[model samples]
Target: MRLVIAQCTVDYVGRLTAHLPSARRLLLVKADGSVSIHADDRAYKPLNWMSPPCWTTENTEGPTPVWVVENKAGEQLRITLEDVEHDSVHELGVDPGLVKDGVEAHLQVLLAEHVELLGVGYTLVRREYMTAIGPVDLLCRDEQGRSVAVEVKRRGEIDGVEQLTRYLDLLNRDSLIAPVSGIFAAQQIKPQARTLATDRGIRCVTLDYDQMRGLDSDEYRLF
Candidate 1:
C-alpha cells in the first residue's frame, strides 16, 4: 500500500462528475491496483476513487505533479498535487476481516444452547435455517411442535421485524412448516420495534447478555 499526503485537487469523470478543491488530503494507491483520494474528515469514505482494473499515468513536467487514473470503461480520475508532504509505501500483507465478540452471533449461540431462553420446551431445529430468500437465525419447534422462525439482532428495530415478517411469509408457504410463527429476539429492542412486532403478531424477546454469556455485562449492556 502506498500512502501520500499532499495539497491536491481532484476531479472525477465517470458516470457522474465531481470535484474536490485544493486541500491537504490523503491519496491511497493500494496493492489491489485501486486508487482513492480522501479528505481528512470522512472516516473511511474516499473523496474520489478509481477502482481496478485501472491504470495511472503521472506527469511531472508540468508546474505541478498530475496523475490521471483510467479504468477499462474510460472513466477517469485526475489528481493534481501542488505540494507533497509525505509519500511512503508499506505492505499490509493480509487482513483477517472482522471478528465480532458478544454480537448477534454470540447471542444466537447462547439462545441455541439454552433454547429455553426462547420458550419452555422449545427445541432448536437448526441454526441458519435456509429459506428461498435467505437464512433465518434460528428455526425451532415450540412445545406443541409448531415451527418458529427467529430473527436475532444486537439491536432490534422496525427493520428487523420487517425482515422476520418476510421470512415468515415465505416459510409459511411450505406445507411442512405452513403454520410457522416468528420471534424477534434482541439484546436491545426499541419501543417502536416492539410495537411493530406486536402489530404484526410477532413475539419480541429481550436477551440478557449477562445471564447468557456469564457476562455480568458485555459491550452493549441493556437493562
Candidate 2:
C-alpha cells in the first residue's frame, strides 16, 4: 500500500462529476490498483474511491506532481499536487485471512439450541433447513407460530440480508411454507444492513456470542 498526504486538487469524470478543491488530503493506492482519497475524518469511509480493475499513473517530471487513476468503466480521477506532506509505502505482505474465536457454524448451533434467543415463543424447527437455493442456517417459528427462516453470519451486511431475502422468497412460494418470514442474525450488524432488512420486512437480531455460549454460566448446554 502507498500512502500520500499532499496539498492537492482532485477531479473525477465518468457517469458523474465530482471535485475536491486544493486541500491537504490523504491518498491511498492499494496493490490491487484501487485508489481512494480520504479526508481527516469519516472513519473508514473514503471521500472518493475507485475499486480494482483500475490503474494509476504518477508523473513528477514537472515542478508539481500529477496523478491519474482510471477504471475499466472509463471513470477518471485526476490529482494535481502542489506539495507532498508525507509519503510512505508499506509492505503488509500476504494476509492470513480472518481469524475469529467463534465461527458462524458455532453461532448457528448455539442459536439453534437456545431458540428462545429469537423470541419468547420461538422454537427451532430444523437446522440447515433445505431450500431450492441452499440450506438456511436455521428454520424456526415465532410466537404467533409463523415460519421464520434465519440466515446467520459473523457480521450482518447487506449481502447477508440479501441471502435471507432469497431464502424467504423461495420458501414462501411453497404452500406448506407459505407466509414465511426472515430473521438475519449476526454478532454485529451494520446500520445500512439493518435498514435494508427492516425495509424488506426481515427482522435483524444481534447475537451476543458470550451470552449465547453461556460463558457466564457453568451449566452451558451444548446439545
Candidate 3:
C-alpha cells in the first residue's frame, strides 16, 4: 500500500462528474490497483475512490506526482499533486477479511429456522445455498412452491442489491430453480437501494433482528 499526503486536486469523469478542490489530502493506492482520496475526516468513507479492475498511470518525472486512472468502463480520475507533504509505503500482510457478527451470520440461521418470516408457507430448502458465484444466505420455497433466493446483510446497500440480482440470474438458469425470485433482507436498507431492488423485481425486506429472535424463542417455548 502506498500512502501519500499532498496538496492536490482531483477530477473524475464518467457516468457523472465530480471535482475535489486543492487541499492536503491522503491518497491511497492499494496493491489491487484501486485508489482513493481521503480528507482528514469522514472516518472510513473516502472523498472519492476508484475500485479495482482499473488501471493507473503515474508520472513522477515531474516536479510533483501526477496520476491518471481509468476503469474498464473508460471512466477516468485525474489526480494532480501540487505539493507533497508525506509519502510512504507499507507492506501490510494478507488481510484476514471481514469478521461478521451474529447480526449477520447468525441472523441467517434464525431466518432459516423461521422461513415463515419470508412469507406464509415458505419452507427452508437450505441455508448457505451454493451458487456459481457464492453461497446465498438462504434458499426457500414460497407459498406457491416457487423458489426464492434471499440475500441477507447486516445493512443493505446498493452493492448488496446488485449481489442478490447476480445470484438470482445464475439460479434462474438452472431448470430446477428456473424462475427463481430474490429478496434483499437486511436490518436496515438504504432507500435508494430499496428502490433499485424493487425496480429490478427483487423484494426488499427489512429485518428486525431482536424481534426475530423473540419470535423464534416463542416458537421454541410452544414446542
Each prediction's Cα lDDT score?
0.84, 0.83, 0.84
- Residue runs of model 3 more than 4 Å from their true location after superposition: 61-64, 111-151, 155-183, 190-203, 208-223
Per-residue C-alpha lDDT of model 2 across residues 188-222, encoded as one tens digit per residue: 99999999999999988888776667553333332
Tell me, what's the RMSD of every candidate? 11.6, 10.3, 6.4
Candidate 3 lDDT at 168 equals 81
Candidate 1 least-lDDT 10 residues: 214-223
Model 1: how far residue 25 lies from native, Å: 37
Q: Which stretches of candidate 1 lie over 4 Å from their true place?
A: 1-102, 215-223
Cα lDDT of candidate 3 equals: 0.84
Better of 2 and 3 by TM-score: 3
Cα lDDT for residue 154, candidate 2: 89
In candidate 3, what are the lDDT values of residues 20-68, reduced to their tens digit?
9999999999876789999989887799988656799988998877899
Least well predicted 10-residue stretch by lDDT in candidate 2 = 214-223
Better of 1 and 2 by TM-score: 2
Better of 1 and 3 by lDDT: 3
Which one wins on lDDT? 3
lDDT of 1 by residue, 35-94 (tens): 999887877668788866689999999899999999888999999999999999999876
